[model samples]
Target: MRINVLQHTPNEGPGMIEDWANAHGHPMVTYHPYQFGHLPNADETDMLVILGGPMSPNDAQPWIKQERTLIQTLRSRAVPMFGACFGAQQISKTLGYEVTKAPAKEVGWAPVYRQSTVIPGIPAELTVLHWHEEMFEVPTAAQLLFASERVTNQGFVLDHRIVGLQFHLEPRANNVREMVVNDYPYIQGSQLNQTAADILTMPVLAANQRALFHILDYITADN
Candidate 1:
């Protein structure tokens, strides 16, 4: 299977998702449209992974608009897609749902309670990294998968193939460290924010990798 990733920033590249793809022997490609101003063709994408960024989906930038169009095109084709943070919001917005400011900027590690068992092997509750100021509403007819105290729309699974997660489950230790160093300003004012030292020292949970791989496997599996 061919896996295509839309990475918004150099620091937010696919972490464990790459690991999962390599271990399974699935060929993968990552596109940085934010820099290159181009997206993968829909026909070539068997599975799509949209990684997070500091930008909002609502931005009027040309690349953002193009990304949304590509997302809509892929959805119409029923391609398997997994989006995180801004990527999630892009999917929601392209589906005609609202992407608005969240009640608060949720940062650092927090527990998200599972609302459905659509994806097997996912724990009822899991603590994951959050670093978004905007959230997407679950698309119509989609099942909400998880929720947290700070954000009600922690995740949603649509059509059994599309998954949108507001948190960072695919981030490895180095990924988290880079995010902390580059995007540390977003963590300062929020009550849920964790200090740089704490975030850097936070232990990497094995369950997070398990949950992420489960979702990836389920979405990309043949229906």
Candidate 2:
């Protein structure tokens, strides 16, 4: 299978998703949408994964508009799409949904209450990584997959093909550290903000990342 990943920033590249793609011998292509502009043929890809960023989905940036258009096209075709954080907001917004500030910001690993009991192997609840200040409303027909204290719409599965997750299923220790050092300003003034020291000092996010792969494999299975 072919996978096209849209990277929004230099540091926020696809994390464990790269491992899955490479291990399975899936052809991987990346588009720095901010640099190359809104990829004209996004829907032509077999699977689309949009990474997170500091920018809002409503940002006035030129590529933002292009991405929005691309997202709309992808949705119309029901192409398998996976979005994280701001990418999730973009997906929800393009699909006639809304994105807004959450009541509180969750910056550390938190438990996700899985409402979709159909997910196999994993427990009904799990601790997932969190990093977004904004949240997205599930598309009207999408099913709720999980929820956290700060956001009721932590995840929504669409047509069993597209998925929007508020948390980072792609997180690794290094990415968490880089985010802490660079994106610290966003959390510094906020109340539930956890430092990179707080997250990196912990034991096991990679295991959780592996679990994330399993969940996604279940969602985007070709068979």
Candidate 3:
């Protein structure tokens, strides 16, 4: 399978996704738009992964505009796309939902309550990583996949293919440490009160990777 990753920053590259693809010997293409100033041709890959970044979807920037346009185009074709954190926020916004600040930052390990009315491929329960100060409203045409008190719209599925997950399912401890030091300034006084040490080795961390695998297997399978 050819999986394309849209990486907005150097530090926030694909973590477990890279490991899984390498282990499975699947072809991979990474679109570092922030550095390259352009995204790859959507027709080149079988899957699309919109990774997380610090910037909001509403940011007024040229690359942001390009990404939004690309996502919209992919959605029009019903491409099997999976979005994480800011990518989820962008998907929500592109699909007519609102993305805004939540009551809390919701950093670290958190239990995501998988809805009984979940997509056919997702697990019944998932303990994913959290590291966002914003959340998005569910698109009207999508089914709610998961929820949490901290962020009601934890996950959503559209057309039984596209998915948007606000929490991090592939969050690695090393990446968490990098985010703590690099993204500390943004969350320092925001609603999400957390530090790198608080969740580096939390038990829930293991489930995050499992959840990502389950999700990937589900989405990549023949429909």
Candidate 4:
């Protein structure tokens, strides 16, 4: 499969998703729109993966608008998609849902309860990384998959092919360290924030990685 990745920033790359693709021998291409302003054509993309970023989906930027349009086109083509954090919000917004400010900011490790078992091997509850202040509503056609205490729409699955996750399940230890170094300001002065030292010490990395790979396998499995 030819997987096309949309990376918004240099720091927020595909993390373990890249690992999975490489291990499975799937050819992957990435576009750094933040620097190059280029997007891939849908005809050449068998699957799409949009990584997270600091920007909101509602931002009045040319690249953001073009990304949304590309998302819509991919959806219409029934191309499998997986979105994380800001990427999830972009999917929600493209489906005519609102990506608004979350009632509270969620940063660091948090528990997300699985609301539906549409995807096999996902447990009822799991701890994952949260680093966004914005939340998106589930689209009408999607089934709610997970929810956290602070965020009701933590994840959703559309047509059993497209998945959106608000949390960072793909972040490995080094990824988290880079995020901490680059986006440290987001952790300051927030009541729900966790220190860099504490976040790095969390023992949930293995569990998160397992869940991420399970979801990826489930989504890309050939029926």
Local distance difference test values of all predictions, in order? 0.91, 0.78, 0.77, 0.88
What value of lDDT does candidate 1 attain over all alpha carbons? Answer: 0.91
Return the top candidate by TM-score.
1
Q: In candidate 4, what are the lDDT values of residues 187-215, reduced to their tens digit? A: 77544668877777886557777788888
RMSD of each: 0.9, 1.9, 2.2, 1.3
Candidate with maximal lDDT: 1
lDDT of candidate 3 over 97-202, digit per residue (tens) = 7899877788766678887454444566676677788898899888788898767888888886788899887657677766666765654553445555665556
| lDDT string, candidate 2, 122-155, tens digits | 4666777677778998988888888887678998
Q: Across residues 1-223, which tens digit of lDDT does each residue of candidate 1 receive? A: 7899999988898999999999999899999999999999888898999999989888888999998888889888889999999889999999999999998888888899999999999999998998888899899889999999978998999998899999999999999999999988888976585798878888779999999999998988783
Clashing pairs in 2: none
TM-scores of the candidates in the order shown: 0.98, 0.91, 0.89, 0.96
Worst 10 residues of 2 by lDDT: 187-196
Query: Which residue pairs of candidate 3 clash?
Result: 105-191, 105-192
Clashes in candidate 2: how many?
0
Q: Candidate 2: where is the Cα deviation over 4 Å? A: none
RMSD of 2: 1.9
